[model samples]
Every structure is written in structure tokens, then in C-alpha cells.
Target: MAKPKILVTRRWPAVVEKRLSKSYNATLNPTDVAMASNAIATAFAKYDAICPTISDKLPAELFPQSRSRVRILGNYGVGFSHIDLDAAKAAGIVVTNTPGVLSECTADLVITLMLMVARRTSEGERQVRAGRWTGWRPTHMMGAKVSGATFGVLGFGRIGRSAAKRAHHGFGMKVIYYDAFPIAPDLAAESAAQSRDSIEAVLHEADAVSLHMPGGAENFHLINAERLALMKPTGILVNTARGEIIDGQALADALRSRTIAGAGLDVYEDEPTIPAALLQTNAVLLPHLGSATRATREAMGMMVADNLDAFFAGENLPNRVA
Candidate 1:
């Protein structure tokens, strides 16, 4: 049988790239740049499967009006909101994403952000880098205490539960979470997290809050001005899930007014284009490095490879979404 043709939309780790080439007739994006919508549409007509990252936008408009040659989209990340599942279903295209592989790494980044924002580590680092730091004093760089504080988690999924473990056991912090669906009692007990009935409750009670929710129309602006107002003035916010989950402009204003203590964000509402207010604030910002570690990235790629293998073999895909 002929090898199923596949196109990797962006550059993946070299080891995974080599593995993919060995498994299938794979074409790597040499420039490592995002493919335009038209290019993606054209590729759909040519390839059996297309591997895409979060950076690629695959809206319903990009899918062919009728069925096309692309049988599957092997997404590299856990989130599938970037691809329009409705359109993929309409076109009879199967969609799969790498989920379990990056959970721990993303949880690590969540904790890193929570600590950085709460302790104002970024500000202090900036001062030191600019040679503006004076001698250490009692009042110098005083920040929030993480120990014994309330750590709120929005969307108690795998990443959120891992963060709760860190906060509860590692830092002696109390963990509380709110999820759209009720969390299983065993899972909640495992994390030592108290489940809340609503997002407002979590916002009002937490000393620091982390977001681990899915992104889409329903969750857009989940943390807006009114919601941010629900938080205590000393509260800190961390977002490693998706950018549209929080209103960046509202967060910026809150930071400027000291309505909230600080914020840490790994993702943005607009990729590569951040609001000026957030850039100017003491907020800890990252360029979506939640799953950037070599191990996690490689694992994600291998997971995608597995899905493609199952798809080609006419077997059930392990991570099929559509």
C-alpha cells in the first residue's frame, strides 16, 4: 500500500520530525511560518492528513464546501478551538489533538505564573537587569505570600488539578475550583480542592486565580471588568489556557488602577500582538510557552503520529474530536 501523504504545517522538534518522516510520507514546513488560509485550503486538497499547531487558524471558512482529500487534522496541542470542528464534521474530516502529554508541563507553567505575579518576581528581575536595585531592605520588593493563601482554579481539568496539587501540597495553599460540570468527589479530594458553584464565587474568594478552561465563543471574555471587579484588590490572576478567556484591556486597566495585584499570561487574545497596556504594566507575560519543553513537545508530536497511524489503518483514533 502507498504511504498516506501528510503535511506538517509548522516546524516540529527534529526527532519527532524524523519519526514522522519514517512513519509516513511527511512534508515539513521548511520556513516554520504559519500557512495562510488559502495555502491551507489548497493543502487540504492535496494531503491525506494535515498537522497543525495552535498558531494556525482553521475556521469553518477554510474547509471545502464539499468533501476534500484531507481525511484528518492531527492537531499538535490539547486545545481544538483553533480548528472549526463543525466544518470538519461537515466535510467528513476527523480531528484529533494531543492532550495528556502536555498536561504536567502546562501545570508547571501555571504555577510559575502564579508565583511570578504574586511575588512580583518580574518587577524585581527588571530592576536588577537595569542595575536599579539598591541594597536589600525590609520593605524592598515586598509581595504576596503564597503559603496558606487561597488558590482559585478556573476549569478543574487535568492541568487545573495538577496546579491544585502543587498549591496544596508544595506551597501549603488552599485550593478551590469552579468547573462547568461537577467534579468527581474523588478527583476533588485528590487535589484537596473545594468545588465552587460559580466563577464569581471563585473570583471573590481566591488570593490568586489560574485559568485552565477551553476557548471558544462561550468562554470569550470570561474574565471581564465586572468579573475582575469581583476579585479582591490584592488578588493575582494567571492565564495559561487561552487568551480570550480574559479581557486583556480590562486586565490592563485593573492593573493600572491597582484593582488587582497582578497578572501572568502565557497566551494572548491576539497572537504576537499584545495590548500596549499589558506590555507597560508589571504583568508577567510569556509567548505561550506552556508546552514548549522538549520532552512535552516531542510527546505531543508522537501522540499525533499515533493518531495518524490509527487513522491510516482504519482503526479508531485515540484522540478523535470530530
Candidate 2:
């Protein structure tokens, strides 16, 4: 039988790429650039399966009006908000994502961001690199303390739980969280996290707030100007979740006006196109490196490969989201 032709939207880890090449006729993106919508629409007719990452935006308009030859969308990341699931479902396309594997790494990044922003390490590094450091004074670049502070988590899922553990056990911080769904008492006890009634409650009390919720229309701009106002003036916010969860402009304004002390973000509302206003602020920004670790990224790719294998073999997909 002929091998199933597959198209990987972005360049994956070398080991996983080699593994994929052995199983199917795989076409990996050499440029590692995001594929255009038109090209993605074209892939529907050409490939048996199309593997996409968080960077790819597969909207309803991109799906073929007619039935597509593509059978499955093997998403490389846990988040599938970038894809139009309804369109995929209507077109009889299966959608699967990689989860669980990236939880620890991503949570680690959340801690990294929190610490960087709280300690003003980014600013200190820049000062030293610019040859402007005149040695440390007693009051030199004094920043907020992280240990024993209240750590608020917006979503208490796998990544959130991991972050909570780090904060409570490693840093001796207090853990509090708010989740739309209820978490088991035993799970909450792991970090001694107390569940708040709403997002406002968490924002009002925490010295550092971390976001780990899903994105999409319902959550678009969930943390707008009003919600941001609820936060303590000295509080710091960190977002490793979907960028659309917070309004970029509002956050920028908050930072500029000292409404909030600082922010550390790994994701943005628009990729590679951060707001100029935000750039002017002292907010610590990273280029979406939530799961950029070599081991974690390779694991994510392997999960996608496993999903694709199960899909073609007529077995139950391991992480089917749609």
C-alpha cells in the first residue's frame, strides 16, 4: 500500500522528523516560517494529514468548501485555539493535540517569568551589558520579594498545579487559585491551594498572578481594564496561557501608570508584533517560550506522531480534541 502523504507545517525536532520520515512520506517545512492560509487551504487537497503548530491559524474560511482529502489535524501543541474546531468537525476532519508532556516545562517557565519580573533581573542584566552598572548599593535596584508572597493562579489545570507546587513547596509562597471547574480536594491539598470564587477574588488578593486558562472567543479580553483595576498596585502579573486572555493595551497602560508594578509575558495577543506601547514599558516579554525546552519539544512532536499513527491505523487517537 502507498504511504499516507503528510505535511508538517513547521520544522520539528530532528529526531522526530527522522522518525516521521521512516513511517510516512513526510514533507517538513524547511524555512520554519508560518505557512500562508492559502497554502494551508491547498494542503487540504494534497496531503492525507496536515500537522500544525500553535503558529498556524486554521480558520473556518481556510477549510475547503468541498470535502478535504486531509483526514486529521495532528496539532503539535496542547492549545488548539488557533484552529477552527467547528470547521474541522463539519469537514469530517479529526483533531488531536499534545498535552501532559509539556506541563512541567511550561510551569517552569511560569516560575522563571515570575522570578525575573519580581527580582528585576532583566533590567539588571541590561544595565551590566550596557556597562552602566556602578556596583551594587544597599538600595540598588531593590525589587519585590517572591518567597512567602501570595501566588494566585487563574486556571488550576496541570500546568497551574505544577506552578502552585513550585511556589508553595520550593519558594514557601501561599497558593490560591480560581478555576471555572472544581478541582478535587486532594489535588488542591497538594499545594494547600484555596479556591477562590472568581477571577476578581484572585486578582484582588495575590501579590503575583499567573494565568493558565484556555483562549477563544469566550475568553477574549477576559482581563480587560476593569479587571486589571481590581489588582493590587504592587501586584505582578504573568501570563503563559493564551495571549488573548488579557487586553494588551490595558496591560500596557496599567504598567505605565503604575497601576500594576510589573508584568512578565511569554505569549502576546499578536505573535512577533507586540504593541509599541508595551515595548516602551518595563514589562518582561519573551517570545512564547513556554515549552521551548529540547526534551519537552521533542516529546510534543512524538505525541503528535503517535496521534497521527493511531489516526491512520484506525485506532482511537490518544489525544483527540475533536
Candidate 3:
């Protein structure tokens, strides 16, 4: 029998590439750029598995036409919002994402963004870079405090719990969170977080809000104008989750109108095209750096490899999106 054919989405670590080259017939994009629908159509034509990322889309229109082909989409990151699940289901393809491997890295990013916004690190950077920093004046570039502040977590998953641990243990923050399903005892005990009855209550009480909810229906634009308006004028918003969770236009308006004090975003509604108004405002914007760490990337890649090994060996996948 011949080896399985796989199409890697982009350039990976040399070791991983070498291992893949030995284990299977792997095809990589010539330019090492993000996979497009046309390229996906072409690549999937001969390959059995298509390694993808959150940026790649596996629409039905681009499904492989070969009977020997069945997808094992090896997503580099946890988020599968880019992949059309229904389309994949219709195409009889199995989609896999590297999930737990990214929780710590993303949690660290969320905390880092929150701290940056609360402590005005971005402003300080701006001041220093613009050569405007004459000295450390008493009231110059001063921002909110984190200690003794109330922290609101939107969805308490592995990443959320990790962030809550950092907030509670690192700082003396009062922790409260809202989840559709009640948080398990392990999480509450682990993070020292209190459960709130409603998301509104969490918004009302928290000095800073961090979102970690999974993205799907019923969550798109959950934090709209009205929800943003509910936050205190002194409240700070932080999101390392999906960009669609918050309305960028509403968030921009909120910042302009001072609806909320400030915000830090690791993701955006549009991946590369951020709102110009947000860029002009004091809000801290990040270019979707939630899981950008080198160590985390390697782990994600390896985990996907493990999932593939399990699948090819006729065992259960390590992390299944379905």
C-alpha cells in the first residue's frame, strides 16, 4: 500500500516538516502563505488530509473530488470559526483543532492585555516612542489599578480558568464570572472565582472584563452597544477570544463616547482590517496575538500531529471539534 497524502497549510517547523516528509507524502504551499479556496481545491484534489489553520476556509465548493480523500484538517490553532462545520459535515470530512495546547498561552495573553490596558502600558510605550516622555510625572500616563478590583470573566473554560487564577493569585482581584452552564467545582476552587447569576451582573460588578467564551451562534456580537453601555464608565474590557464576539464599531463608539473607560483586544472582527477609529482612540489593539508564542505554536503543531496519528491508527482523535 502507498502512504497517505497530506497537504500542510503553511510552512511548519523543520523537524515537523522532516518527520512529516518521512511518514507521509506531504505537499506544502510553494509560497508558504495562507491557503486560498483555489489552492485548497487544487491541493485537496490529490491529498487525503488537508492541514489548515484558523485563517483557512474548507467550504463545500472546495471539497476534494477523490473517493480516496477524507479530510483530517489539522488546524494550527484552537479557533475553528474560519471552517464551515456544516459544509465539512456535508462533505463527510473530519475536522480537528488543537485546543488545550493553547489555553495557557492565550490565558497569558489575555492577562497581559488586561494589565496593559489597566496600567496604561500602551500609552507609556507611545509616549516613549514619540520622545514625549520628559520624566515620570505624578499624574502623567497614570491608569487604573488592578489590586482589589472586581474581575468579570465571560465564559469559564480552560483558558478562562487559567486567567482567573492569574488574576486572583497574582493580584488580589475579586473574581466573578458568567457562563451558560454553571462552572464546575474544580474551576471555582482552582481559580477562586465566584459565579454570577447573569452576564449583566458580571458586567455591573467587574472593574475589568475578560472574555474566553467559545465562538458560535448565540455568541456573535453578544457584547453589542447595549451590553457595552451596561458596563461602568470606569470598567475596562479585555478580549482574547474571537473578534466577532464584540461589535468593533460599537466598541469604537464606546471608546469615543467614553462608554467604557478602555479596552484591550487580541482579536478583531476583521482579521487584518481593524477599525480606524479604534486605532485613533486610546483603546489598546493587538493583532490577534492570543496564541502567537513560539512554544505554543510548536505544541499546537505537535498536538495536531498526535491527533492525526491517532486518526490514521484507527483510534479516537485526541481533540475532536464535533
The backbone clash count of each candidate, in order, is 0, 0, 0
lDDT of 1 by residue, 41-70 (tens): 899899999999999999999999999999
Model 3, range 21-81, lDDT digits (tens) per residue? 7888888666778766797777655787888876676655676444426567777788887
lDDT of 2: 0.95
Q: TM-score for each prediction?
A: 0.98, 0.99, 0.95
> Given candidate 1, what's the lDDT at residue 32?
93
Which tens-of-lDDT digit does each residue in 1-322 have in candidate 2? 9999999999999999999999999999989988898999999999999999988999999998877899999999999999999999999999999999999999999999999999999999999999999996999999999999999999999999999999999999999999999899999999999999999999999999999999999899999999999999999999999999999999999999999999999998888789999999989999999999999999999999999999999999899999
- TM-score winner between 1 and 3, please give it: 1
- Model 1 stretches with alpha carbons more than 4 Å out: none
* Candidate 1 clash figure, as a count: 0
Poorest stretch of ten by lDDT in candidate 1: 114-123
Which prediction has more favorable TM-score, 1 or 2?
2
Ranking by lDDT: 2, 1, 3
Q: Which prediction has the highest lDDT against the true structure?
A: 2
Better of 1 and 3 by lDDT: 1
